[model samples]
Structures are given as structure tokens and as C-alpha cells.
Target: MVVGYWRLAGITSGLACAAGALQAQLLVRAALGARHTSTLVHDSIITPFVLRPALAPALAVTAATPLDERWTAQVTLDFSTSTLERHDADGTTTGLGRVSTLAFTVGLRRPLGAGFAAGAGVGGLKYLPAGETGIFRSGAGGVLGLAGAVVSYAPPRVGGRWQLGIEARYDVHRFITPALRSEGFTSARTVHRIALALRAGRGGAAGAAGAAGAAP
Candidate 1:
């Protein structure tokens, strides 16, 4: 009796491992297949879903004017492009499509006493999709107003007129597409984005001379 039970246990464990491997393969296939066809699974309703952007590189240009010793007025133009991913209730994700993002922001920055500065920005965010498929079936969503905050650090004791810096930014906006609304989405989802980037240019500090000014 004991020998027979041991054999049954070994078979069960082996079957479990095989099932896990098969499930992983199917998951991968589903993600790849989503790019080719829309009929991944037909249900009563497409209902609501989540779409997210992958980590992307951002390019930016800025203009600034000193307001006072501690404050500076700044305007920035930024752009990023990456793939949009769809998140489902089953915790599985697929690539919906590629999207390019553009934004124009105006903000004010003030130093934090140790080469760090904090700023708040208000702007408009626009989405440009490569194709009008997936959630962008009707068209790319219109531009939405957004607000963001940034923190930057620059070593004041280095560099010439150009002061190199690092910045971290965070923003939030509501997202909803025409196709998503038509498919039964009632409310827009709040989307949050965060980026960390290296910045080179004016330190944007007021009344601070860089290393070049002090060179004898």
C-alpha cells in the first residue's frame, strides 16, 4: 500500500510542473497574438481595462529667467515615445500599440539650499499613436491638461557657465479613449507618470556664478 501511494505522489508532482510550463507558454503566445488579432477572447462585453506606457527616454528643452535670488521662472518642452501596454483583470498584459507623448510646461523653481531645487508645473499632454488600432480605434485621445512636480540637484561648485544637473519628475492625468468609452468604460482612469533624467544647461539658479566666472 505504501509503495503505491508514493508512486501516485510522484506522478502528481510531475503533472503539476508540466502544467505550469504549458501555462507560461500560452501566456507568451497570447501577448504576441494580441498584436495581430483583436479577438483574443470574446466575452459578453469588452468592458473596462487598463493601458499603460513602458519606460521611455525623454528629450527636453528649457528656457528660464531668474525671478529673484532664490527663484527662477522656467518653461520646458518635452517628448517621449514608447509602446502602450494593456493590463487585464487576470494580471496578464499585452502590447496595445506604440504612442508618442508631447507636453509643454511652465513652472517656477527655488533652491533647497544644497544644490537641490524644487518646482511645480502645469501643462497640456498630448498623445500621438503610430496607428489607430487597439484602444485608439476611433482616434488618439485629445490633449489633456496636466500638472507635475520636479526636484533637481546640481553641484554648484563644478562646471563653467553650463551647470549639469539631475532631475526627477512626477505627474498625474486622467486617461480615457473614444474607443474605450464606446466599449462600456464610464469613467476615466487616473494615470501617473514618473521620470528621472540627467539635465545639462543653465542651472536655473538666480545670481549664482559658475566655475568659469571664478577662473583666474
Candidate 2:
């Protein structure tokens, strides 16, 4: 009985210490609109088409913890739903039904003064296809790895613990699949995306009043 009591006490203290060490600030955001450039999927043989995802109307959530006086560590999660579009040589386009994209990234952010901040990070992107068709006949490239970066602007706190801001983000990744490889394509195409959104978060006044970007 004494050993059991000691074990329970150890567990409780461990939980308390973890909770005290990892104080995180949360931010919720929604994309005003988004866009992706057309990239060549396959070239020089068979039916060739360029691929692009109609990006818009997405949402994101971010959690951040201050690492120092000038830097903060953050993780962001975002997702979008759209049609996977294919463009032919003749410039005609076809929609490949409903597709969903989910992404997660870890990054560091620092204030650039005057309500501006810069951040960069790396992440993974997964494509969920509605059906087995088009280039996704085998699967949407198996969770392509990606690199992402962001810039944001947050005004002075509006007399509260939560704050509002705007952010611009960009991501890049290589696109390929077993289906593409089987179709005589040997190389992966580079895909790029850009987005803008409005965000509201718990630590908006981090850097504005010489708070040094620390979460309160």
C-alpha cells in the first residue's frame, strides 16, 4: 500500500510539472482566399496535363510558446477542400471531384518591429482524394514532404488577452506518385502555393509594448 501511494504521488507531480513547463498560446485563422500555380505533371509522352488545386476558403489553427525574449516556437495546422484540376495542351480543364488537403508545420517566429513578424518552418502535406481517378489513381503521392514560410502583422492589443492579426504563407513540395511513375514519368514536379488569412490569438500583444514577444 505504501508503494502504491508513492507511485500515485510521483505521477501527480509529473503531470503538474509538465503543465507548468509547456504553456501554449492558441490562434485560430481562416483563409480569405488562396491560389496555386499550374505545374507540369507529365511531359513528352502519352496524355499530358498540368495540375493545379483551386485554393480558397480554408482554415488554420496555431499554437505557440515563447522560447526566449525574441523568439517563439509554434506549430500550425491547416486544411483545405477543393477540386483537383487538370489542364490539357489545348487549354481545356477538367475537374477531378472533391479533394481535401491537410498540412502541419513546426516553426520559429520573431518580431521585425512595427507590428511585423517573420517565421519559417517545415511540414508535411497529405492529399485525400474523393475517388481513384486522374493522377490520383494510385494515391495522392503518399504524403509529400514540404517546406513552408510565413509573415504576419498584428496590431497593438485591443485591451485584452486575445489579439487579431493577418498572415501570408507559402509552401513548396515535390509532387509525384506511383501512378505517375507507372505512366512513364520519372521525375517529380515542384508545386508552390500562397495564401492570406485573418487570425485571432491569445497572445496578440507579445511584441507591441516591449513585451518581447513573450506569451503571458
Structure candidate 1, residue pairs in collision:
none
lDDT, residue 61, candidate 2? 77
Query: 193, model 1: CA deviation in Å?
Result: 0.6
Tens digits of per-residue lDDT, candidate 1, 168-205, equal 77777777788878888677766777777776664322
- Candidate 2 per-residue lDDT, tens place, 1-216, comes to 999999999999999887654442233334344645356364643766667776656677777766666777778887877887777888898877887778999988888887788889998988788988767898877778889888888776642555567788888888887788898878888888777877666633334224444231
Q: List the residue pairs that clash in candidate 2.
A: none
- Candidate of highest lDDT: 2
Quote the positional error of residue 13 for candidate 1 in Å. 88
Residue 22's lDDT in candidate 2: 46
Residue 137 error for model 1, in Å?
A: 1.5
